[model samples]
Target chain A: MRSHQTVVDSRLRRRRTAETVFRFFLLASVILVSLILSIIVVSILWKSLPALKLSMIFKTPGTGYYLGKRGGILNAIVGSIEISFGATLIALMIALPIVIYLNTYLKKKSFLSEIIRLFLDVLWGIPSIVYGVFGFLLMLMCHLRASLLAGMLTIALVELPILSRAMDETIRLVPNELKEASYSLGATRWQTARHVVLRQALPGLITSTLIALGRGLGDGASVLFTAGYTDRITTSLLQPVATLPLAIFFQLNSPFPEVQQRAFASAAILTLLILFISLLTRFLGRKLSRHRIK
Target chain B: MDKGRVLKKEKGRLVAAGLISFFPIFLTIAIFLLLLIKAFPLLSLKSLPDLIFSSAWQPQKGQFGLWPFILGTIWVTATAFILAAPLSILTALYISDYASVRLKKWLAPVLDLLAGLPSVIYGMWGTLLIVPLVGKFLAPLFGTYSSGYSILTAGIVLAVMILPTIVNVSVEVLSAVPAELKEAALSLGATRFEVVRYVVLKKSLSGVAAACVLGLSRAFGETIAVLMVVGNVPVAPVSLFSPAYPLPALLANNYGEMLSIPGYESALNLAAIILLLIVIIFSLVARLYLARLSRRRDR
Candidate 1:
């Protein structure tokens, strides 16, 4: 009896020690992840503080900006916004309808929906560099030069899968009873979709749009060859556009400290824009969920 | 007249939506076909073995071996997976099994934000921090010389980028492990950790594998962040400290100037095709696996 009790006590102690070690390991991993995230944000902010100025957001780069001359990143800021918004608009036009069709018109677990979802998933996984290559090919075939129009179309393709999938998941969450109620009122499928499904999914739709927009804004590879960065901002769709991502890439590559500083500044602006969009998504998602019927 | 016209209008709308829905499939096919067609010249010019096995990459001399980039991608991706898998699994376990309700709620959006941050931002951070740390500290510690831009730096950056992806999917899979099984294990006098390790991990093993595969696919295709920090040397990486060039980086760096060299454009296209194939295979396999896992669980 004494020997058995000692064995049990030792086993219990070993198990307790093992449990404590495992718990600590998990806690440390979480802390490490949070630390990494904070480091990214803080480092970017710290690096950009010296070079970031309000004028950078309001003025275009002047002559010899790459040589560490005085200038601003207005061209990049405006161009990033324009390209992303245009791409989001295009992606939304196609994505919203497809999502609506999938959720309302198709039967649950239908073959077509399954295949479409798979295709979107694959597309979403395709690298931006592949999209860049595809976009370049399309441009060549069309005899189009690198321009804002080219950038917008390319980014729209990139955003399409992401936007549609996000919207699809959101629309799928709308309770079936709500849709049935609309149908029982003798509403046509289109009316039910337009009024009921769309309204219920508005928050998600907006959130997905912003998400796609943020993605579009941050992508540099797709526009590396297709967008053809320029110093001055041009309103024409045909003109090559400066974008924040490309701006950072090009400036960082320069063998000049001041220019590298500007790159950090561009990075800061891009990060801020993405951060704002993310916060807006959370805020709007909660605020708009109030009217949503679960 | 009213009912007939209304029905006809609804039918028309359905047809339109259906056609629009086909766009994804069509786009997928188009991308594949276009890449194949563009890559055909290079595929025909060089024998498959020579192209894939040879490391010679002189564009001016019509040499376009892809072994270096392929090997680089493998090295970087493998390192990333090594570093990320354990951390992500542990983080997921913590989130699902250990975190309080309030902590879980806060962590969700935080992870999402991390997921949604632009790859360029990660690249920038990697360039500023990871590169310096590797070159200044890590290289000396290992008694090696590095230029700060190396495969290891890229891997560390990529590991951070893919952490959220693996963790999110894993949390979902971990959470799906039935509470009853955990409770049963607890009643047997098992510790929470033991229950999680024995019951939850056993049940969700396949799902977690699928999640890691998904993260691998993301790491494979990530270009900008990897491109920024990965020393884009055309040589195959022999060590963690060696400069490496990945396929996506190869295409991103060269496609702009490929018009000047004969067969260069085709070689770059072939690289893109290779990248697309790898990413598609990994993603489809993982998605199908997860889909089947969920179906089986439901049953």
Candidate 2:
């Protein structure tokens, strides 16, 4: 009996020790993520300080800046904004309809919706580079050269799955009873979706669109070949345009120290843009959650 | 007339919805077809085994072997999964089982932000911070020459980039474990940790596995960031510190120039096809596993 009791005690002690170690491990992991985030922010800022000027936001990238003269990445900034906006608009137009159709046209557990979702998942899992390759192929097929329109089309493809998935989740949360109520009031499915579903999911839809926008703006690989880089900003969709990520990639690859500093500055700008979008989405998400029908 | 108008409107709406719904399916098939069509030229250029197993990638000499790139991609992605899996699962567990409501709220957005951040920024961060640290500090300890751009640096950056995906999916899985199940475990004299370990983790094992699969898919497909810090070497890496090239990186780095050389376009297209196939398989497996996990939970 004494030995049995000792064995039990040892087992209990071992289990307790394991629990403690696991708890510490969990805490360390969380802390490590937070630490990396702060480090990324701090290091980018530190490195970018030499070239991040208020004037940089206004001036176009001067040619031969790799020779260590003055310039800004405004051209890339404007180009990024144009491409992202165009892509997000296009994605929203397609995604909103698809998500609405998925939720409304099909039964809640419809196999069609399941299959559609699986397709989107596959598309979502495809790498940005593959999308770029596809875009490049499309460009070739059409006998079209690289341009902003090509980039927008490629990014639209990339953002479609993300936005649609998000909107689908939110639309699923719209109470079935509310749709029933709309239908009982003699509303058509299209009217019900427009009036009840869209109204209810407006906040979430906005947030999802913004998230997709952020993705479209920040993606480099998808646009690398499709949107051939240019030194100057072009308003025309036919013209190739530069973007912050490609600019940073190009500048970072240069042998010049000043060009490298500019890469850091571009990094800072890109980070700030994404951070702004993220914070906005978070704030909107919180607000929507508070208003959500539990 | 009024009833006819209503019927016509309904038909129009349904048709519109059906057309839109078909778009994703159409797009998926189209992408596959496009890849296959463009990559067909390589079929005559080299045999399948020779193309994939040969190690030399001299474009000028028309030698397009993919074995080295495959090896490098596997090494970087496997190392990233190793580094990210434990941390991500633990963080997910903490958030789901241990965190307060307020903390959960705070953490969710940050993870979302991390998930949404661009891959290029990750590459930039890898270049600016990880590479230098590896070159100046870590490489010496590993007995490798310092260039800051190696398989290890790329793996570390990919690890960070993949963490949010794993954590988010794992949290969703753990959260789906019914509250009563956890309560019962606690009532049976299990400590909080014990309940989490035996009850939550066990129940969510498949879901966590699914999350890891998704993360692997992401790591495999990631391009510019991995391209930036991976040193772009075409040879297979012998060690973590050695410079290597991944499939996506190779595709991205060479696709532009591929058009200029004979048979190069077909080679790059084959690489993209390989990447697409691997990522698609991983994603489908993940989706299936997650579906099974949820079904089991529901039962």
DockQ of each: 0.84, 0.77
- Predicted candidate 2 versus true structure: per-residue lDDT over A101-168, tens digit per residue: 89988887889998998888888888889999999999989988899999999999999999998899
The Cα error of candidate 2 at residue A175, in Å, is 1.0
Q: Candidate 2, residues B1-299: lDDT per residue as tens digits?
A: 48789879988988898789888899999999999888788868679899889999997888889999999999999989999999999999999999999999889878887887788889999987899988888999878696989999999999999999999999999999989999999899898899997899888888899999999999999999999998988997898888899999988887866657777888888888988999899988998888777767677
How far is B156's C-alpha from truth in model 1 (Å)? Answer: 0.2
Model 2 chain A lowest lDDT segment of ten? A285-294
If scored against the real structure, what TM-score would every candidate get? 0.98, 0.97
Candidate with top lDDT is: 1
lDDT of each: 0.92, 0.89
Q: Runs in model 2 with CA error above 4 Å?
A: A1-9, A288-294
Weakest 10 consecutive residues of candidate 1 chain A by summed lDDT: A62-71
Top candidate by TM-score: 1
